[model samples]
Target: MRLRDHVVVVTGASGGIGRATAEAFAREGCAVVLAARREEALEATARECGKHRGARTLVVPTDTTDAEAVEHLARRAVEEFGGIHVWVNNAAVNAFGRFEDVPLEDFRRVLDVNVMGYVHGARAALRVMREQGRGTLIDVSSVVGAVTQPYSHPYGMSKHAVQALGSSLRQQLYVEGVKGIHVCTVMPATIDTPHFQNAANFTGRKVVAMPPVYSPERVARAVVKLVRHPRREVVVGPAGRALVRQSRTAPAVAERVMARQTEKTHLSRKEEAPATHGAVHVPIAGEGSVHGGWGGRRRTGMRRAAVAAALAGAAVAAGRRTGRGAPGC
Candidate 1:
């Protein structure tokens, strides 16, 4: 769909990937609706979006866990912009701790925000799209949706559920002969976002993204691309794709590697963080930005090399399985 003047609604727009996505769509001249529990942050995002191509922006403070709030968000978007062309569900929260150490309430909160939130958004968007007979819905999942990670049990579970939700919804739409309504899932690798800082921490350590973190803008670009050419799923970074492929081919090996890597690097013992519920139960007040501080420290060159090697290995394996020689051989 042409982005110019199209109405796009993005959840979790207070910060991180959602904020970047809102700005990206705005650059394409789309009228954007920014929704999150944080009113101030949503307003801040609205201001930034407005600066792009003179795009019109609406700030709707929505807690996606609440079905009514999410429904209201969709209603407001259409009330203000005529119709919903695209809807991006990106709201999420995480808690870092061992499965046994984390509180059950926190685990449920993660599911409520990450899984139920998407469900609410999808339902609302689908209703509008079914009526209009056309629209796009993008669900921002994660690589962990395919491969489980240590110290983030709840998060991994929620993402996995999101993947299932998207697939099921797509199949339902197809069975019903719905057309022009596309459901796309975007699974990104570790992103340099404030997600770690905002997560509910019980590990008694500072949370950090593993090395080779991709920038939020990278994922945002993928979301924008999906607006025009929707696909079933798109993994944003090479590291993410590699991990997903590895998990599928060698689940035991992948599990061991992730367990060790996460334990060693995903948490920092030097910095101390008190246990807090974060935004799981309440909204945070602040104007959040796109890039988290981790970007400057990323090991880009090494990551690129690793990705290239993984791709080459996959190609060779494919050739062998098909009883074919390498290209030019």
Candidate 2:
């Protein structure tokens, strides 16, 4: 469970949870391999990892949606690090729009990265881990995996599939007598990451917003726990935790309430000019730029973030209680 000296491979390491988790593991003395589609970003994240002395780091630019590329990522990790002990499947994308409005290509893309990305990572890591006799596959799922969301059906579907696959894989490992290898899922609510901003906005509404968002470091801290002691699943943030609890205790009521709340909300309306579907904007809000200030200034950032997180958590809880979503800001 000690990460010191362990070899860890993190997908989607360019930013958000991946970057934070990579740095966190590095600080614990783990040899880290950071992977992402952007070579520059991956390299930069690896450099951050290097700041933690004694922890060697490598940058492998990879497109998780591609099976061949993912295979290369695994081979490179083993070739360089000797072996892989922990593989964090954290790469994903989202498109915000009604099912009818979202393009089929977008749906396929989301599934490929979110669902198949985990499949590929788990397959590659499981092979190495099974041979090593001990390893862990940590998946970064979302709160939507367990609940419903408006204007983000594609993302929600992909995450739900991930949750299902994670559970099935865990059982498969048990059945195969793979004792040391563990498959776990991290289901979090809206964390303050670039994911939401990068989310394709086709909802015909501008100004994307969420009531509350948890800091990426909170998620990083949770991943650290999984590295130390793997669990079947862990929900981040109070809202996320409460929703999971509510889902279990009142599945019908929860679904009905969530359905109603989503119906009342509007998603992103950002549109690209004709012939250009690609966007250069930061994928999500608070991405790239650090919130609050530098170094220890996280204190101020955390204070503000805590309030938002509380509001988000309360909103979800209140929605469940009242079966209605409050008006958007």
TM-score of candidate 2 against the unseen true structure: 0.82
- lDDT of each structure? 0.90, 0.77
Query: Which residue pairs of candidate 2 clash?
Result: 194-284, 197-283, 197-284, 198-283, 198-284, 205-269
lDDT for each residue of candidate 2 in 160-202, tens digit (9 for 90 to 100): 9989989999889888877888888999776656555556666
lDDT tens digits by residue: candidate 1, 145-264: 998888889999999999999999999999988888999999998898889888998888888888668888889999999988899999988878888899999989888878888888
**Which 10-residue window of candidate 2 scores lowest in summed lDDT?**
273-282
**TM-score winner:** 1
Question: RMSD of each candidate?
Answer: 5.5, 8.9
